[model samples]
Target: MANNNSTDKQGGIKNNNLNKTEEEDEKKKNKKIFIVIGVAVGVVIIIIILILLLFTFCRRGSAGETEATGVEMTEVMEGSEETETLEDTSGASGETSSETEESTEETTAEETTGEEETTETEETTADEEAIAPTITLATYMGPVYSSADGVCYYRVQANVTGTPAPTIVWSRNDGSGLGPNRAQVNLHSPSETYTLTATATNSAGSDTESITLSWGCNRPPTVHEITLMGDHIAGVDYTVSAYATDPDGDTLTYQWSASGGSIANPNINPK
Candidate 1:
């Protein structure tokens, strides 16, 4: 009986150790399952995050394409409006567009081009209008003529054209005229050179020309008989000398000159 009781105690102790080891093994299996589940959850969350980022990128790309297309459409629309120039349908005239009426670059570029052009034209016209009316001098010739006998006097002749018939200004350095073109002077004085300068003037401008008359000479003087020094004596200066009669032929004298230059013999005929 004593042996049987000892054997029974040993068997009980072995059974307790086996049970403890089984419990420990079960706990390890449960912990491995929990770890695997946690790893899977983490992987799934990472995939979801990646998917969300991809979706956001796609939305941004689509938005960019829409914006770019919109801008291009707007530019095309604006360009068409700027380039389209339809003809006007107004009635009442039989006039057509002129070939020379070319549209300027500004016309196509700006909306207010017509007004700007009109303003410019008006200003230009105003500027040109400020200048006064000009007169063309048609005839500025002649030292024209005047002579004194009983009631006659030294005169000048010229044909001038201006707004108003030019007023005559006469200068007589030769005491041959009484009060100038309208006066008479004694041609019987000591030989003297007479100059007749005339200025033709109008309200706008004035011009001058001169001629000389010699008095107290031996014979009838050809007042302005220009002599030739060369072959073509068109506009050349020359020494002048001529004859003048004292009308009564009572011992006459002579004086000759150019504008102011004197002649050699004032009382005799030239050789």
Candidate 2:
């Protein structure tokens, strides 16, 4: 590359002092510019190498400086282009090998700093994932009723489900744990039997479901109809039976009473 040019060439456009055509001059200028850039890259590489070498050999400091100066000269080869783009133009005077060491140190420092920044970025991303939406229980508990006092309250559990579960809120007008599931409906008032409902939620979403219960408590028996065994004999003893029902099956007992009515035969009364 250095051989391509002659000292007598005007403006250093080509090998000879002979005047070239306008096209030829333009092409030559472009070629030189490219060559200058390549040389600049090489100088930069040399600076890096010199810096590494200097770390071990003190004498190489001057060698590194010289390489760096060459890089500066190559850069100046394109100096008239722009000033800001030519930041390291100082390389011309920094020809001492010491400049090479500085270049390498700068690269090392940039690498270290970049690595730490990358690590911090990864940690921050992980933290964001850790704090992802959480499912919270907005409200959860069983509802109670007067009959439920002695029996298990058919608590229709309520909850919220979404990213970040909401807080659970509940109230029982009966001052009992027996409240409607979130809807504030009074259960067990009209419906002798009711199904409990519940909701699950998170900050992002919510879902609901029914809660099951097995109520086995006895309820006051309701008398529906009465039946007699059979037509009774004038003086015979017979049994009169009663039919009753309760939500829960409970054994029933019987007692006989009379009002104005008496035993069919007072004289035949056994007890």
Candidate number with greatest lDDT: 1
Q: After superposition, how far is residue 87 of candidate 1 from its true place, in Å?
A: 8.3
lDDT string, candidate 2, 37-155, tens digits = 99999999999999988786876777899999999998887675666445555556466457778999999999999999999999887655442333222224344334544443432
lDDT of 1 by residue, 10-98 (tens): 99989999999999999999999999999999999999999999999999999999999999999999877666522232331234333
Q: Residue 81, candidate 2: how far off, in angstroms?
A: 8.9
lDDT of each: 0.56, 0.55
Off by over 4 Å in 1: 85-271
**TM-score against native, each model:** 0.32, 0.27
* Decoy 2 TM-score against native: 0.27
| Model 2 backbone overlap count | 46
Q: Residue 202's C-alpha lDDT in candidate 2?
A: 42
Give the lDDT of residue 260 in candidate 2: 41
